[model samples]
Target chain A: MVNRLIEPTSGRILIDGRDISKDDPIALRRRIGYVIQQTGLFPHQRIGENVAVVTRLLGWSRKRQRERTDELLTLVGLDPARYRDRYPSQLSGGERQRVGVARALAADPPVMLMDEPFGAVDPIVRERLQNEFLRLQEQLAKTILFVTHDIDEAIKMGDLVAVMQQGGELAQFGPPDEILARPATDFVARFVGADRGLKRLSLSRVGDLELQTAVTAHPGDDAEEARRRTLADPFRYLLLTDDDHRPIGWVDQDDIPRSGVLTEALAIPMSPLVSRRTTLKDALSMMLAADVVAGIVVDRTGRVLGLVTVESIAAAMRPPDRGVGAATDGSGPDAARRLAAELAARDDQELGRTEATRA
Target chain B: MEAFIGVFAWFADPANWQGPNGIPTRLLEHVVMSGVAIGIALLVAFPVGLYIGHTGRGAFLAVSLANIGRAVPSYAVLVIVFPLSIAVNRETGLFDIAFVGTLLAMILLAIPPIVTNTFAGMRGVDPDLVEAGRGMGMRGGQILSRIELPVALPVILAGMRTAAVQVVATATLGAVIGGGGLGRYIVQGIARFDYQRLVAGALMVALLAIATELFFSWLQRRAVSPGLSGRSVRAYENVAQLGRVDVPAV
Candidate 1:
């Protein structure tokens, strides 16, 4: 309806404030970018021409089209020199999808309509493309109405997700965290699946949480002092740090010798290393893998900042961003509340929260 | 071997090279008549094919015409137009009665392949490409010219190639209609029982037909973008150019 590919029998679609049904569909679509699963590249055209199709359509000069084509290809991580002259048949599925995105972005349209653009590639390639597109989205920030059948993809890609039922009826429209925390309908609740609370864990990042300061000791420091400090903290684990403050590993308080200097060999197995941008869900999963209470949060240089415990991840599960949506839902928020409370009560080694959060 | 020697000697005879009914005169006559017929066929079939192919309208008509063309023989069309040529120089600018009959027959014979192939090629273009073009705000004319035309060129040319070859081979019957062409050599050689001229005429027609096929192949390579035909062009040519060769009714 946005592009008016098929006219609606009822209802109007508005872009800014005006109904697009009244607007010239050709002109309206020109202001939007479009990408599809097949990539829909003109097989007769070169890669450079395919990327710059919209620019060429918009009457840009030949020189400008060439420059923009090269620029967009490079932005999408394809080397313009290598790929520009090749045909669509010459590129891989992933490369063709990138060109589809690049072509859509060619005219710098304010709105983008993407229909399962990454669905054609294998899972690993899809993940990489999704990450690359997300990074690019951070910079470009174009409004995208992405369509996908996979609910996991919806939860991952969309900031404001519109869950459509089987007949194109709007089931729910809200932010990913909100919908996950509190789905509008049973269809949506079922659509997001039983693991919606765990899915919501992906929404909040480690940087957003106030991490705990674990008891720290250098390799050459006194083991007695380190043991005392570890015993004092509620976590009861000494984080071994190097001279650069980069974490070595975790050390149990009982494992520390009475009066000897703390050596590098005294450290037990390492906890998973996490960065600030790491999702709370991933952080929790990583902590669960090592059967530890905490994940060491690191900076870009891999220097330890602080520790994110299970409690922080549980706290993030709450839907803090609802207005009218708080009243309509039945099971989502209540389930999330019970799971978060249950999670908050567990010990650091209680990584069995996954099996317990059935509600 | 003896018959082949006589044909070579016929070619070496300078007498066959001169005069209004000579080799050069007859060859020019053959090319002009066939060339004019092809031009007219193109003018008639090309637009109708594109219109039907692009709009997806009148497809039944194109299919029916193609089927009818395939079912009817070249001699049958020439026979059908045989009576029509004697009537009144129907439209002005027509020169000679046999030329009129043969030209009409050639034009009729040429229409179906050009129309069928053009329609097939145009419709063969992926609809996704057309949709993408429209979604990108390309106008109807722009889509047809820029996307559909370039992509469908090989198929369209293949149709033309078939039509041209068929017309060249069938033009041999123009000599039976009392018209001038390389066909005259075969007709006169047969009538005079001159084995050499008869073989020579058949060989010359065969050579012209081969040259037409190669010329179209080169033209297709030149006209179509390499990107489109980069890998499967040879395969596509084999598929589309099938059944084009017709044995002349000598």
Candidate 2:
């Protein structure tokens, strides 16, 4: 309806306060980008031609079209030199989807309608494409209407989600955080699922948490000193680091010899190493999968910064009380209160999980 | 075996190469008749076939027309049109009775495959492609010319190949209706009891049919989109396979 592919029987669609029904549909469609689930690429055309479709229709010169095609292909993370001359049949499903997105963005339409754009790919590729598309959208900022049946995708991609119930009636409309935190109706709540708090974790990043400093020791450090330091700390494990301050592993106080130097062979394997950009949900999942109490947070250069424990993550998810500063306290009345709330929240999450499994 | 040897010996004789009734002239006549009949049948069938295929309307008409074209014997058509051509000639002095009758027969033989294949080809184009074209804001004509035609070209050409080969073989029937072609050699040889000429004429017809098949096969390959047919190596294999099934019923 937005692209004027099918005319609505009763209502008029307005774009920029102008009724699109009054505009020439071809001109309107050229000005608005459209993408569907199947990627809809013309098999007979080369990738270059597919990307430049709208540009050519708009009468761009051959040189301009070629330049734009190359630029768009590169923007979609496809190497223009390698992929431009290839046909759609030569590409993988994900590659074809990238080309589809490139084609839609060719004319740089002010509005884009994406209907399950990443739906055709596998989960890994879908996540990668979703991230790439988000990164591109950060730079472009085109007014986008993204449609997907997956609630996770809708929450992840949409700034303001418009949830529709059966029969295409709008159930609720608001920012993803609001929609997840305070669903407008019971249907909306059920649709978002009972694990809304867990889902919200995906929205927050590991960088947002106040990480605690892990007690560190080099491989050649005195084992007796490391053991003393480990016993003094609440977490009785000494993090062994290389010369560059990157984590190698952990050494338990019980395993430390009385007066010998620490060695790489003595340390147990470290927990999951997550970069600051990792989402809280992913970080927690990795920590759980590794059966560790905390994840080592690393910088871009892979140098260890600090550690993020599940307690700290749970503390972060609680309602902000005093300030960001007090939330970092490992043991206080506020921390105790937050821990109680976290326990209650975990119970609620467990209930939600069982309900989800039943459904 | 003796007739086959006699066929080669007839080709070796230089005397048979020289006049309007010679091997070369008769072969030319045969090619022209086939070409004319195919051209006329294409003009009559292509538009109707494309219309039916594109609109998806009159599907029954396409099927019924194809069935009717196939069911009517070419020999019967020749005899039927012979009287009509003679009547037209008597009324207007414009049409040649024998030529028109024979041409009509060959055209009737060619139409079924051309029409059926064109309709089937267009119908076979993925509807998703057509929908994509429409979503891209292509007008009806643009979608047909740019998207539908290119994708369906292979199947359509295969159909034309079938029709062309069939026409070439069927045009030999012109000899039965007082028309001139390589079929003259067969008719005369049979009348005079010359087995050598009969074998030579049959062999030439076979060679002509083979040449027609190869030419159209090449044309089909050239016309199809490379994306659909793949690269040259795979496409050559496809053409070889296409040859086995595309042979005319003759």
Candidate 3:
């Protein structure tokens, strides 16, 4: 309806405060980016010409169209020189979706309509495309109306999600975290699912948390001093780094020799490194998979910044109080409180178990 | 065996090649008549097939026309058109009666395959492709020309080939109405009870039919997209292998 592909029978749709019903559909659609689930790429045309469809229709010169095609393909992370001349049939499903995205953005329209654009690919590819799309949206900031039946995807992708019921009625509309935390109706709650709290973790990135400093020592450092540092720390472990400050591994206080030099051989493999851009959910998954309670956060240069513990991650997921750590910043105190309540409940169960044993 | 040798002897005679009623003249006449009839049929049926296919309307009309064309034999059509052509020529003071009657019969024989194949070909185009073209802001004419026509070209060419071969074979019947074609030799030889002329004429018509089939098949291969016509090339190879088996007998 926004692109006027289908006209509304009763209500009028306004874009930029102008009623679109009265506008010429072709002229209006020219200014809007439209992408469908199947990618809808023309198999007969090369990727370059497929991406340049709208530009050609708008009377762009051949030189300008070629340049724009390359630019759009490059923007979607496809190498223009390699992909430009290839037919759509020669591309993989993920590559086709990338071309589809590039084609929709060819005209650089202010608004984009994506209907499950990444839905056709496998799960791994879908996740990659979603991350790439999110990164692209961060730069483009185009007003996009994304439609998907997957609730998790809705929470992850939409800055503001509109939950619609059967008969095309709007059930709720708000930010993803807000919609997840407080569904407007029973249907909305059921739709968001019971694990809404866990789903909300995906929206927050590790960059949003205040990471705690981990005690560190250089690989060439004196073993006595490193041991003292490791023993002093509550975790009793010291992270070893190279000259560039990139983390090599961790050394337990027990593993530190009493009178020798700290060497690379002494350090054991560390948990997976989490970048600032890594989502909190993914970061936690990495930590769990590595059987470690904390992950080292690194910068783009791979230099260690600080450590993110499960406590801080859980703290960030807490419910909002005084608008601090709300969905806007992906931090809240409610998650910490919820964690405390669960711990207390566990303790009660443990106490009851002991009493039953005595009886 | 003796009759076949006599036919070969008739073709070898230089005098038979130089006269007004020579092999070249008869072959040229046959080709022109078939070409003109096919051209007329294309002009008449192509638009109707295209329109019906693109709009998805008048499908019943296309099917009915095809069935009717098949039911009416070319001989019956020629007999029916003879008196109609005479009356129309008298009223309009135009059109030679014999030529009009013969052309009408060949045209009726050619329309069914052309119209049926063209309609089926256009209708078989992927709807998603058409929708994609429209979604990209293509006008109706652009979609038809740029996307639909190219994708449907192979099937349409197949239909044209069918019509061409059928018209080439059927044009021989024009000799019955005094139309100038290679069929004239056969009709004259039969009337005179001359076995050599009859065999020679029959051999020439058969060769012409085979040559027309091969030419259209080559044309079809060139016209179709490589992606769509992969199996066709292999199918042609199989037919060629069969042709090799028949070459020894010749």
Candidate 4:
């Protein structure tokens, strides 16, 4: 029987169209930057020297090393002028982590392996660092293999989340939303936690959902006209705004008179509103806080963009049923059983070795 | 204080540099003997201590034996080695007895600190750092040389400092065995009741010890970390300028 880990595994591990296993591990390792759990800064060296150490080892010129160090320091959000000469002991934990990242990015390797680099820091710093990394990844587009135990963090960070089970076995590999919505197995579901629907929103962006074009009614418009617009629309409330497009309140159909301006009848108090950039998670939180069915999505100028309803959110939360046979496809139960039996046989041999060592 | 100054003045006199029995020469010989003993002790201890530290087996035995060596007074070791040398000298009639005896005594005195410090330094290396080095594909030799030795260097140097001062102070024991250096002046001055010469010899040893310590301390600072060196002002300036960006978006 073939070893499950060393043999052809469940999923293909690729880097830039090349199989990770096919290449020389040494050459592959050089192309990939790895940052471990601890910030591996050499305490004896200056910050500039520490950042440049790997680049120097990689045979870069002294001039190129200096240039790359400065660029990465700036890229990791550290002012090169301030931190370049300091030792590791002098900097705060957050600063050291940024320096760690700068060191990893020094050679500009196409791939990065970060294993809980920010796990040791406080929550506030962790969040800021995570967001900063997100912004950096957006700019660099490096293929990142980030190993984190935090499911929320994995959902937020990974473009393709590969959930690892006990003994470093891959449990599931897919887009974050797909995994959160439709977990592959019982282990995957439990690992993702019971509140998988709420976790799904963290992966869903505002761009993914359809936005409602709100009916705009000026506060100075004729009351009957505003009433007509409100009555014509399925929504009972007409969004009342000033001439400058600043949202004032809503005009209910019942409160409008037959004629005259619609001012006093307008309810000045509005429900909670959130920015367009707000995650569906944040929008849901706002919706819950305001005890409202929907929230107004506004731009930076506070002009109304659209509405987010409970139906749209619920639709996103619902997991489309992918039956058990979805993975099996045309390869019948016989083939899957054969593969599992081969894996089990290999696992037995390894297990026997482990037991013998214990004895 | 007045008496010391007077003695210092008398010792400073150029005429006193000359002696009927070559007192100045004996004092210079004593200084050289002490320096040689300390250097040999360092050579003997550093490698043995490093090997014992790297290999876990027999480390406790080595360190405990070193402690026992330290506990046995230097004079006691000298006395023990002196009789053995007398036997060798009688048979061979070829060896310098005093030099051999003084070296044995000084080497025994220096090993304990080096062994204990090396063991502690090796154990004190950050386990994560070792794992990091290993994860980077460094083998045992490379890890010990590149990672372990460099990190343990400061502690090892500190141990050497202790050993140097200890050996230098203990070298005075050689004068009792008639081995040359300031100790000979000290011994002669005592026997002849020459207070000025004794004071001069003591002053020289004390000054030399202080100078050696200062020199090793500077070397230790340099060998360990450039930032920890006396030139920390520039490093501090660089640190102050490190992170002055706008508040990061959370």
Candidate 5:
């Protein structure tokens, strides 16, 4: 209805106070960006033209379109120079999804409608694309009306999540944490799932959690001293970092010899490395998947920031228990309050959100 | 089988190459008439096909028309038009009935594949792509010309290929109605009981048809976009079935 793909039988959908029903659909659609699950890239068009489609339609100069295409592709993390002339078929599913996003962003529309945009890719790629999109969103801040059936996706993507029932009625509208913490109806509750509290873990990023310091030892450090330090910390596993402060692996305290200098071989194995921006839910999943109790928090350069342990994540999941000293940063209680305030602020904004892509 | 041996001998003769009734003149006539007929068919069929395909209206009528066209043989159309062209030629002295009749028959033969294929090509484009185009604020015209047209090109050209091949092969019937074309050699050879001429003429016609087939196939290859290259074989397999020409080789 927003782009007049379908007209509402009743009610007006206003994007910026202008009723979408009354506006010229062609002009209105041009002002809004659109993406679909399949990416819907014209198979005949080159990537550059695909990205610059709206610009070409709006009659931008050839040079200007080229510049915009490069900029948008770069913004979406695709190297424009290499991908510009390539066809959509030549790209991987994930790459094509990126192109789809870049194409939508090409015209720099204030509003974007993403209908399961990353739905086609595998779980790993979807996560990567979602993270990249979120990072891009932080920069661009387009008024995006993202549509998805996956509740996890809905909770992760939407700043003001709208839970639409089967009949297209807005069941619950609030921040993701609110919807997770408090379902307005029985339908919404079941829809959010029995593990809605665990789902709330997705709402808070690793950055929100106060990381626990892991005992570190350089490869050439005295094993006696390293074992002493590792044994002293609550987490007995020693975090091995190279000279440049990049994390290598974990050295079990039992594996450390008492007298010799520590070598790279002393470390048993590496845990899944996570960035500060990773959701606590993903970090927890990574820790479980690695069969370890902790995940190594790394910076952009892969330098060790600290470790986010299972206990710390659990501490962040609920109100900070005063008994757990690891959550001293108090992310759990603070995250809840911050999420509540964010939901309250979002309630004030009147946006008749999204059109579901059910069929 | 015995006469087939004389084909080489027929081509070797200098006499066959030099006269007004020579190979070059006949070849030129065949080329010129086929070109004109296909050109006229394109002008007539493309817009109709494009409108029906793009708008998605009158689809049943278009398909029925195409099927009806395919059912009526070009030879029958040529024979029917023969007397009508004669009447017009006698009255106006502006056209040769045989030539006009043959051209008309060729045009009629060419239109169906082009029309059906154009429609199929337009329809074959993923609706989501069209939706995407429309969502991006492209007007109906822009969607048709830019998005639908290019993605649909291989299929459309496939249709044209079917039409062109059919027209080129069927145009040989022109000589059956006192027309001028490479078909003239066939008609004249059979009339004179010159086995060499008959064989040679038939050979030339077959060669021309082969050349036409190769040209259009090359064209179809060129028209398909790089973006569609990965799955084009599969896509074309589906679309080709729609525009498939089952007309017997004349």
Candidate 6:
């Protein structure tokens, strides 16, 4: 019933512009992997055997099976040496889902259909798996159709959001931000939530944009001077740091002393120091919890890199309200079409450079 | 009552331990009859039961065949097999009527439980376990041998135990048909109204049956892991105590 429901009735379902439905279903199924919601796995079989079953059934030789199973284990971020001999009953839910994905990709499928694969795991593990999948998707470039009742998950993972209605009709279809900003109908609007604008920030990452500067102070700086700097600047806090320029803490304007050294005594420990590589979604959560307007973005060495303010987060979150026209162009549809062409040309140029490098 | 006690005391007396009327020979005959019958039943029923279980399609036919064997009373089997054995060995004139007829009757009595238990055990395996095997690309034969057989072993053993005890008890029927056994002593006692030998024969058969049952049950427990058997017992108990129950098609 599930296969029939997703089956293309009139025309072929294309992947990478190739009509694969007319081809052999065995071949098609091999190239299009699927992950069910419950991470359906054989509890009695060892994890490696579970992943290798499809490959063996497909008549891959022993050497090839070994190679492919190991490759898939690494691909799903599970060390084959550790997990190969264990059974599904012995694994955590997240690990089971990872194995599920590995098994689906057993034949090196170019397309993956995931049906709420992370639903069984706790939130922290789910988030890690989601991010890991995103990184994998970026490298593999597989055309993925991920299903979830979770609108947040849909927004976070989907490149092109396709909201399905109660009876499984396409309710809305567009980019994540566009669908969130202007839902096609009441159903979509309610589904994305009334605060859909805020939810969009979860899809944006800190690495996607440039950061703004903030007031900085050395640990040996006079407390009076740090207070004077905070009063003069628009930002309320001064970022305190060590002599080596690593961010130590921050001194709020109200907490600074008159004529003493600005040591750890005057500074509050930095609770929301997000790395520059952190997702805006994660940064926003930290900022919200800290009740601070901005987060200090640090490097690997904890150096005070820059700050992510509320305005940058808001700007990253908000979509241009004027539908498709405002999306590509600053002006109108003709200009927007030109902008799309230019972006495509730029992508083509980058591809050409990569090929040249390969040559 | 006084005469019964005197007879009992006479039997209990050490002087009559190996006395006349072939008392020692009768006890030996009883042990040999039961041991031979059980041995033959085990050899025949176990393999046949396993075969019927693996096939799984002809449950009604298999069950009917087994039930027919059981429905034929021990006396009937003895009466039927006696003449047949004599006719086959007529030229040799060496037919051991008592031993051979008792063996046939015991085999008939033992088969029903073995066949029924085997079928029930094989059928009782959770379908999900079989599906998991198929999904792992296991062939039907491999699934049956590696997964199904090992899991159903205890239940199969339980059935065999029941059949064994039943057969050992029923071997006494051999005595009435000129079949030499402790049953010969039982028949002699009844003819002369000498209750002492009759009570002794009856007690020996009861002890043997009880001992066989205990040994087989211990074997069954040892065949499967303790944890798995305990879980199965607990699960069955919970279902039984549910009060409003939907009976399954067993």
Best by lDDT: 1
Q: Candidate 1: misplaced stretches above 4 Å? A: A219-226, A256-265, A318-359, B88-94, B232-250
Runs in model 5 deviating more than 4 A are: A205-359, B1-5, B231-250
After superposition, candidate 2 runs with Cα above 4 Å error: A210-273, A290-298, A301-312, A315-359, B231-250
lDDT of 5 by residue, A1-359 (tens): 77888888998899878788878888888889999889999877778889999998889999999999999988888898778766787789999999999999888999999999998999999999998999999999999999887888888888998888655877889999889877887557666766887899878999998988889989999999999988888888998899889987888999999998989987777999999999888999998998989899999998999989899988776643335565533379876785575466443322222232252
lDDT of candidate 3 over A1-359, digit per residue (tens): 78776778898888999998888887787788878888988755668878998898889999999999999999999999778866677789999999999998989999888888888999999999998999999999999989887778888888899887755667789999889877887557656765787788888899999988988988778999878887888876889999999999998889999887889998898978999989898999998999999999999999999999988998887765536534542336766675565566665545443332222
| Model 2 C-alpha lDDT per residue in residues B66-95, reported as the tens digit of each score | 889888877787777788878877998986
lDDT of 5 at A258: 95
**Native contact fraction per model:** 0.68, 0.53, 0.25, 0.19, 0.96, 0.06
Candidates ranked, most accurate by DockQ first = 5, 1, 2, 3, 4, 6
| Alpha-carbon lDDT of model 5 | 0.84
Q: What's the chain B TM-score of candidate 6?
A: 0.78
The lDDT of each candidate is 0.85, 0.84, 0.82, 0.73, 0.84, 0.73
TM-score of 5: 0.76
Docking quality tier of model 2: acceptable
> Model 3 over residues B133-218: C-alpha lDDT tens digits?
77667778978876777678778888888888878878788888888788888998999998888888888888998998899888
Q: What TM-score would each prediction reach against the true structure?
A: 0.87, 0.81, 0.80, 0.82, 0.76, 0.57
5 versus 6: better DockQ goes to: 5
Query: Which candidate leads the pack in DockQ?
Result: 5
Instruction: Return the interface RMSD of the candidates, in order shown, one decimal each.
Output: 1.7, 1.7, 2.9, 4.9, 2.0, 6.5
Could you give candidate 1's per-residue lDDT for residues A1-359 as a string of tens digits? Answer: 67887798998788878899988888888888999768889887778888888888788999999999999999999999878867787788999999999999998999999988898999999999999999999999998989886677888899998876655567788999788887887556666776888888887899999988878999989888888888888887899999999999888888989998999888888889999999988899999988987899999998999999888677666556656666434467787785575466445213222222211
The residue-by-residue lDDT of candidate 2 on A316-342, one tens digit each, is 777554466753546878778866766
DockQ for all models = 0.49, 0.39, 0.23, 0.21, 0.50, 0.07
Error of 6 at B117 (Å): 5.6
Error of 6 at B15 (Å): 16
